[model samples]
Target: MTFLHSFEPGGVERVALRLHEAWRAQGRDARLVMGRTAGAMKREWPDLNKGGLGYEILGSERIPSSGWETLWMIIHLPRAIRRIRPDVLFCAGNSYTIVAVMMRVLLGKACPPVVAKISNDLTRSDLPAPARPFYRLWLRIQGRMLDRLVGMAPPMRAEIGTLMGADNARIAVIDDPSLAEADIQRLAAARAEARAAPQAPGRRFIAIGRLAAQKNFGLLIDAFARMAGEHDRLAIIGEGAARRALEAQIERLGLADKVRLPGHVSPLDAELAAADALVLSSEYEGVPAVVAEALAAGLPVVATRCSVSMEDMLGGGRFGLLVPVGDAAALAGAMSDIAKLKFDETAARDQSRRFTVEIASHRYLALMEDLARA
Candidate 1:
C-alpha cells in the first residue's frame, strides 16, 4: 500500500517528515510531496530521491505568494494527487488540510481515504474577515470528504469539529509527532557542549519561529529592551519578510548590541536547551512544538496566552508564566519572574513525554489502519 503525505515546510512539515519516516520504516510505501512554499522542508529533507519516497513541488517560487497564486494551489494539488495514485493520503498543516479534503471529494473512493491532521484551533471567530467565507466553505467540505481528522490537542479537536460540523467520533486527539526521544537527547548533548565551551556569561534568551505578524517578535524585542540591563543578550531564530523591519526596531530601541537575529537554525532543541529561557510572543498558535521542546529541555518558558492550547501546554501557568498578547509590560513582568523561577528537569521532561513522536505516530498509524480497512 502507498501513503501520500502533503504539507508545507515549517514545524508542520517537520512533524509530517517524522511520520513519513516512521511509516517508511514500517515497510509501507510513503512519498512526501511538498509545496514549493515549504522551503524549510526542501532544505532539511534533501534526500527525497531515495526509494519508495518522492518529493513533488507545487506553487510559486516565492516563499508565500499572494492573490491568484494561493488560490491556484487548489488547482495544482488535485493533479498531483492523480499522478501519485496512492492507497491513502495524509495531509498536515491547515492549508494542506483544506486542499486534501477538496481532493478527496473530487477523487471519491478512487482516491482512497484521506486523513487531515489539524495542528491548530480554528473555531475561534478571530479569523480575518475576508478569508472567513472561504474558510467556512472549506471546513464544510472537510466534514463530508475527510475520512478522519487528527488534532494535536483536545481543544483543537473540539474547535475543528465544531467549525466543520463534524462528528466528535471522527476527530482524534493525537500529540504532534515531532518531539522524538532522540531529538530530546541530541538537544541535551548540544546544551551540555554549549555550556562546557568557553561561552560568555551573558544571559541569553531565544525565540524561535518565522518572523511574521503572528509570531509578534517585535513585542518580544520591546519587552527584552525593558530588561536590557538584567539580561545581557537576546536572539530570535527563524526568518521571514519582517526581518529587516525587526532589525530596524532593534536599532531604534538602541538594543543592537544586546539583540541578534540569527536567521533560521536546524535542530532547535539544542538551542532551546542552551538558552536561559524560551519566550513565545506569538499572537496565536496551536500546540507550539517550540514550547514543548523548551519544556522538555527544562527551560523556563514565558509565553503570551495566544491560544487555549498554550495554557494547557504550560499547565495553566504552573510550568511557565503567561502574559497577555501585545502587552509589553505584562511580557516584561513575566520575563522578570523567570529570574526567580526554578524548573525541575524531570517534571518538565515528564510533561513533554505526553507529546512524543512515538506515541503520536502510533495513534496516527492506528487511525490510518482503521480508515484503510473501512
Candidate 2:
C-alpha cells in the first residue's frame, strides 16, 4: 500500500499513481490510501475513481491547507494501515515521513516496514539560514525512521547517503518512472519527424509545473521579458495558488502577448513534440518528470541548478542548459542562446531510458519484497 496526502497535481502524486498502475498491470496487489480524494488529478485522471485499482480515503471533508491535510493524515493513517494490513508500507514523499515515524511509534512492532521515496532535494538552499540546521536534523531523523530510502536517480543516492547519514546498503537507486517504454518510443519517433520537417524561424518554449512559489514561474516570466524576441513565445503549463500573481506579472511586464498560461495540459508529449525547448525555473526539485519526458522526446532544456542531480540530468551542459537559481539575468541569457545550441537527439533519448516505468516497477517490487521477507 502507498500513502498520499491528496491527489494534488504534483510530480510526487502523479508518479505514485503511475507506479500503482504499473504494479497492478503486473498482477501485483497494490492499494492506495489518500487523506482526501480532491485535486486537479481527479479531473486529469478521471478513471482513477472508476475502480481499476482499489483505494481508501481517510477523510471526507475538503482540506483548506496543506498543514491541515498533513494533520489529517497524521491523525488517521495508522488506523487505515491497521485495517488494510499491507505487508510493506510505501511512504510516497517527504511530506509523509513524519506520519511514517508516528506509525512506528503508535503501532510499535505491529507497523509494517516503510520504504520511503526521497521526493525532493535533501539540500534545501531555499530555506532560511537558521531553518537549514533543523531541516538537516529532520533528515537524520528520517534515516532512523524509514526502513529503506529510495532515491529516483543514481546521483540522488549519493546525496541521500551523505545528508541522511544512512548507510549505502540502506539506500536504493531507482528511476523516476515518469514515462513508459512505449511512450518514450512514440515521442522519439515524433521528434525524428519534427526534425525532418521544415521548421519555423520563431521558437516556442514550453514550461511545465504547478503555478507555485517552488516553481519560480515569476522568475521565468521576468527572464523571458528581458530576452524574448517579438516573434518568440513562451507557454507555461499547469495551475496552482500562484496563478493570480503570475497573471499579474505577465500583464504588468507587457508579456501578455508573448507569454500564455495554459493551465494543466495532459499528454504533454504532444506539446513537447511541438516545441523547440523546455525551461525549468524551479527553486528546487528531485528529478523533475518534465525534464525526463522532455529528454525522452529529444527536447533540449534550460533549467536552474536547483538540485544536485541537475548536473547528471543535463549531462554537464551537453543535453541541456543549466542556469543559476533565482538569477533572472543568467536565465535570460541562456533563454536567448538556447535556439543556437544543437543537442544530440539520440544521446538525449538514450539518457531517458534510465527513467522508464517498466524498470522502476521491477526495482521497486524487488526491493519491497526483499524488505518484507527480512
Candidate 3:
C-alpha cells in the first residue's frame, strides 16, 4: 500500500501515480490509500478519482487545511494499515513520511517495513533560519524511523546519506519514474519535427508546476519581462493559491499579452511539441520530473540551480542552462541568450531515458521483492 496525502497535482503524487500504474501493469497488487479524495488530480485522473484504480479514501470530503489533513492522516493511518495489513507500506514522499513514522510507532510490531522516498531537496535552504534546525531534526527522525530510503538519482545518494546519516546499505538509488516509454517516444518525435523546420527568433517558453510560492512564478515573470522578445510568449501551466498573485504580477509588468497562465494542462505532448524551450524557475526541487520530461521531448531547458542533482541532471550545463537560484538578472540573461545556446537533441533524449517508468518500475519491483523476502 502507498500512502498519499491527497489527489493533489504535485510532483510526489505524480511519481506515486506513475509507479502505481506501472506496478499494476506488471501484475502486482498495488493499492493507493489517501488522506482525502480531493484536489485537481480528481479531474486529471478520473479513474483514480472514482476509486476505480484501487484507490481508498480515508476522508470522503476535502479538508480546507492541508496541515490539518496531514494531522488527520497521522492519527488514522495506523488503523488503516492494520486493517489492510499490506506486506510493506510505501511512504510516497517527504510530506507523507510523518504519517509513516506515526503509523510505525502506533502499530509497533504490526507495522510493515516502511520505504520512503526523498522527494524534495534535503537541504532546507528554502526554510527560514529558525526552521532549518527543526527540519534537520525531522530528517534525523526519518533516518531512524524508515526501514528503507530511496533517492531519485545517483547524485542524491550522497545527499540523503549525509543528511539522514544512513549508510549506502540502507539507501537505494532509483530513477525518478516521471515518464513512460510512450511519453518519451511521442514527445521526441514532435520535438524532432519542430527542430527540423525553419525556426523563428521569438521562442515560446513553457514552465510547468503548481502556481505556488515555491515555484516562484513571480521571479519567472520578472525575468521574462526583462528579456522576452516582441513575438516571444511564456506560458505557466498549473493551478494553486498563488494564481491571483501571479496573474497580478503579469498585469503589473504589462506582460498581459506575452504571458499566459493555463492551469493544469495534461498530456503535455502537444504543448511541448509546439514550444521552443522549457523554463523552470523553482526555488528548490528534487530531480524535477518536468526537467526529465522536457529532455525526453528534446527541448532546451533553463532552470534555477534548485537541487544538488541539478548539475548532474543538466550535465554541468552541457544539456541545459542552469542559473543561480533566485537571480532574476542571471535568468533573464540566460533566457535572452537561449537561442545561441547549443543543444544536442539526441544526447538530451538519451540522458532522459534513465528516468522512464519502465526502468524505475523494474528496480522498484526488485527492491520490494527483496524486502518481502527479508
Model 3 CA deviation exceeding 4 Å by range: 43-46, 49-52, 62-67, 192-201
Q: What is the alpha-carbon lDDT of model 1 when measured against the actual structure?
A: 0.74
Lowest summed-lDDT stretch of 10 residues in model 1? 1-10
Root-mean-square deviation of every model: 3.4, 2.0, 2.1
Q: For candidate 1, lDDT tens digit of each residue in 154-255? A: 667777777887898888889776688877776667767777887767677889988888889999999998876734788898988899999999999999
Between candidates 1 and 3, name the one with more favorable lDDT. Answer: 3
Each prediction's Cα lDDT score? 0.74, 0.87, 0.85
Residue range 168-265, candidate 2, lDDT tens digits: 98999887888888989999887777778887667889999999999999999999999988888899999989999999999999988889998987
Off by over 4 Å in 2: 49-51, 61-67, 189-201
TM-score of each: 0.87, 0.94, 0.94
Q: TM-score for candidate 1, please give it.
A: 0.87
Q: Pick the candidate with the highest lDDT.
A: 2
Give per-residue CA lDDT, model 3, range 23-84, as digits (tens): 88778888888777777777656676343457787754544546687788877777788788
Looking at model 3, residue 374 earns an lDDT score of 89
Candidate 1 lDDT score at position 355: 81
